[model samples]
Target chain A: MANKADTIISTLITRSRKPLLDEWLARQATMAGSGAIAADGDVKEYCTRFLAELDTGLAAGEVGDIRGAGWSGMRELLEEVSRSRAGKGFTPSETASFVFSLKAPLFALVQREAGDNAARLADELQSATTLLDTLGLYTVEVFQKAREEVIARQQEEMLELSTPVVRLWEGIVAVPLIGTLDSNRTQVVMENLLQEIVSAGAQIAIIDITGVPTVDTLVAQHLLKTVSAARLMGADCIISGIRPQIAQTIVHLGVDLSVTSKASMSGALELALKRIGKAVVERKARPAAEVS
Target chain B: MDQIPILMVGDCLLVSIQVDMHDQLALALQDSLMTKIVETGARGVMLDISSLQFVDSFIGRLLNNIASMARVLDAATVVVGMQPAVAITLVELGLTLSGIRTALNVDKGLALIRRIIDGEEQAFDRREG
Candidate 1:
């Protein structure tokens, strides 16, 4: 029963492939305010490839279950299109519309092929609509997955970029944290700071939190854990960049940071240098007038 | 019965735990460490746990007990060379090891112990003077 309907739909798509591709492209071009901004050649190529795959997929008689072996080629093609469009900055709806716009041209062909037979036209229309709708929704699903993967990778990069540990002196290193300290980011921050401490053989680490916007109890606890971990590594940690508001918040929360803290990075550096028995002294500026 | 060795270096006793220590072995280590501290009159104890990958609350409590015992014996205890994962795990397990000093490695741990002993000597000298 399904085979008969599949055969009819396959014949209609294969016979009118070019006209179907042209009509779909024409509709896409005239569709106002989609804001897709894709090149005309690219859009036409996508439509042509999609129609060819559809012809093959419908001929295989597995239009119902896309996961069936016969539909693998079409599925792979749609996955490719969805991934590329996602990378090319196409919105989900815009990408799905590529598959959706075929309905109009396809329905017209089904109507012409069915002629005056109401039952045949209804059957063809139902099968075509179901197949196209499944393919369209598949593209959307792939597009969403691709977008999520891109976002996850970008988030990892941001986590790494935000927690940079710089060696300030021979025995001192500094980590300037710049975002909210969640548990995951704290793990990164702790690992980076500890690894730097080992490589630099640093005796002191100055964690500057000036860029962090706020300090709740959890943030305070994470900071203390970092300090404790650094202390366990034999490197004393001095927290710098405690603004007046953060200080008030810390006190109000009654969280004992317990470690030495300073108002600024420079102050922390000075104390770090003092602890290491090293002093940064500016060479007395030679009489400025002598050179002039 | 395998025992973790306690080597005496200068005025400090160094115990390098190279095996995955069990509860019984840890308690035995505590006993041996205390006995050695008294016999040798060591001024400090340094436990190198760089090779220990995981430490549970039992080992954590044993470490605290060792530190307290050393303190009562008038000796300072410094735990050195803790891996980063072990440190994080210890923190997560709520074992802060407070009252026990820690160093990054053996060399620094020795330096820390020497400084404490030297400071004590200076204080003693000041009292005599």
Candidate 2:
């Protein structure tokens, strides 16, 4: 009875006039394979239950356009199963297998809907999995829309990190560094530092790392890139706040900071002020050109 | 010493800590502090650990937890007033807080919190107004 019902649901879903029903059945076909279904009876039962609930949704006008909603609803049903006590007790391996089974179907769904952005969606799916791991939540297949959202968020961050902030101070500009200096963040720092240097029209730009924790080779390389860019911009770049550990890391990495002006923040400030030929307090006495 | 008293200033909760705080005390305080941070909807937090002489793995883990929780709550955290000696010891011992906020002193930390919570615009307005 169950095997027959599974086929019926799959057929009805595939050929259903309601977009939601069709989409739902297509999804079912993905999960109802010989081994994953465990039993033909279970597959049929799941399909029957889905069609019944979807029919209720259609009757009440709770869902519109069966095609889109069908796929989404199936995902929701799976989520409910995963959330239930019975679902929670599944062995990690079983749970993983269940999710893995739906991967191809999810990919197909996204590829059909997303068109050109399917590859991007795949990366986002991976990122979402990583994020879920951080939260200690495990799932077999995440909804396509959720993966899209995570991808969108990552893109937004990339834009924000690349946006440079300009800090102008009496013909000198100083970009204060904050937080841990990891490899990725250092890339952002390098971009912002060089761009700000060129746009600010300052002779000296100070990169203060006072707030940064220990620096590794990756960060040192980033700092080097900033210095290179600053010289190219016809401005001197100074690295401030070299903590002992960072200095040690630089030595260990055999990366030279020779071209870069390495100084404490105060020293950088003093040098910047000197280049402008005007001290902070003597701002009124200097001509604009002398200050620049 | 008396138990550390936690205070909420603006979007930040500042905890005045004591020296030689045991792991149990630190963990307990961290829990309450994080709960208060979430409740108050603060954007930043400062821990004044001027009194703490040593921090243990449990305390480190607690700090990391608080930091992680603060992130979920959209709060920036800093532990302030950690003595240089203590800071050095923590680094050497590899006892590091995962997500907790830190500051060097109360005033500087407060300034940092102001910067993080209000941004430059708010800071400018506060100065002018």
Candidate 3:
């Protein structure tokens, strides 16, 4: 049999969409207060759009199961609203309230129309509650998904930003290592350093690990991979910024430190400059240029 | 029957591989380079692979073979302009090419080869003196 509650609910909404929307939006306005949604006429537009989608969704008399093909439009509209509100920094409760707040106005309309029939009133009320609750929960799900997507994209951008290949001179480039070096991070560092070596035609590359917290065996292996890749690209790589502790750890771990290493960036730069047949010497004190 | 050309520049034999190398072509280049090295009495060999973009284990072995063969003829071999991707692949394949000298580009390769030759000559003179 066709759903009686769906029939009654659709009829009431078709008769009083204007009144229902007005009451629901009034509740939302008070709830929204100084929030981003009601600052303009946007909340009204969303309500109008949602009511229109609800009208079509209920016409097919399948309100008990929103997953049916008939309710796809309603589901799509709620997802859009949830995603946008999530990106706009709305709390989960605030976003779900967009659907939940309609319950008061809808129940009142159903209650008034089903007067003198307690059984009919109970049936429509239960159906309406279930439908609204389902929509609110679905909205929350989409909202969380949107937030996760934003976080994932930001993490990717941070990974790319962390490994910057900076050209230190005509044929010298440097990568300042920070944080822990995992295999994935090492791959990014290796690719970036090799690309810079080819583009800058760099002969000397300095890997500065001053900001790295600790060096484990895996981190050492990752560093070795990057160094080997750099060497294969015909660029000499010098590891600098090894603290006293890191040096002791390296020897204790029995990790090979045969790759040229320096205690500071300046020392590495000095050695690199000399390797390229250059040097940095201070001038005599009377060196000011004059315009006569 | 595509052949790689070996150009003689100054005292070095310059072989810039411009095509994808196959077995026969690689062997031909190796054979002819050995003959050319002997004929010109070149002291250095420069391999400019900057234009070639891809490599496999075969090419890696070919590079090693050419370097060692040139070394046997008393000529130093320097490979230059290895692309980043190719280098990573070669490293992953565990071919370090340790027996060969390397430079960033042709100009640097020429300078490195000159240093290698001059350093050897100076060592010989020092031994005599």
Chain B TM-score of every predicted model: 0.94, 0.75, 0.96
Q: For residues A1-292, write the lDDT of model 1, one tens digit per residue.
A: 2555345668877777777777887888877545563453477667777777777777677767788777887889889889988998888888888888888877887788879999878877787788889999999999999999999999999988988999999999999988677778877898899889988989899999888888888778888988888877678899999989989999999997798999999999999999999998888778879858
Q: Candidate 1 local accuracy as lDDT? A: 0.86
Position A6, candidate 3: lDDT: 49
Per residue, candidate 3 scores C-alpha lDDT tens digits across B20-108 of: 88788888998999999999999999999988877777888888998998888999999988888888877777877777788889998
lDDT for B104 in candidate 3 is 82
Chain A TM-scores of all predicted models: 0.81, 0.48, 0.85
Model-by-model DockQ, in order: 0.54, 0.01, 0.64
Clashing pairs in 1: none
lDDT string for model 1 (B44-101, tens) is 9999998998878898888899999998998999999888777877887888887788
RMSD of 1: 4.2
- Each candidate's lDDT (Cα)? 0.86, 0.57, 0.86
For candidate 2, write residues A22-130 as lDDT tens digits: 4444554555332443433344444455455544433433232323543455546545544431232444344344434434443344345445775655654453243
Over 4 Å off, model 1: A1-7, A10-73, A177-191, A210-213, A281-292, B1-13, B18-43, B72-75, B125-129
Better of 2 and 3 by lDDT: 3
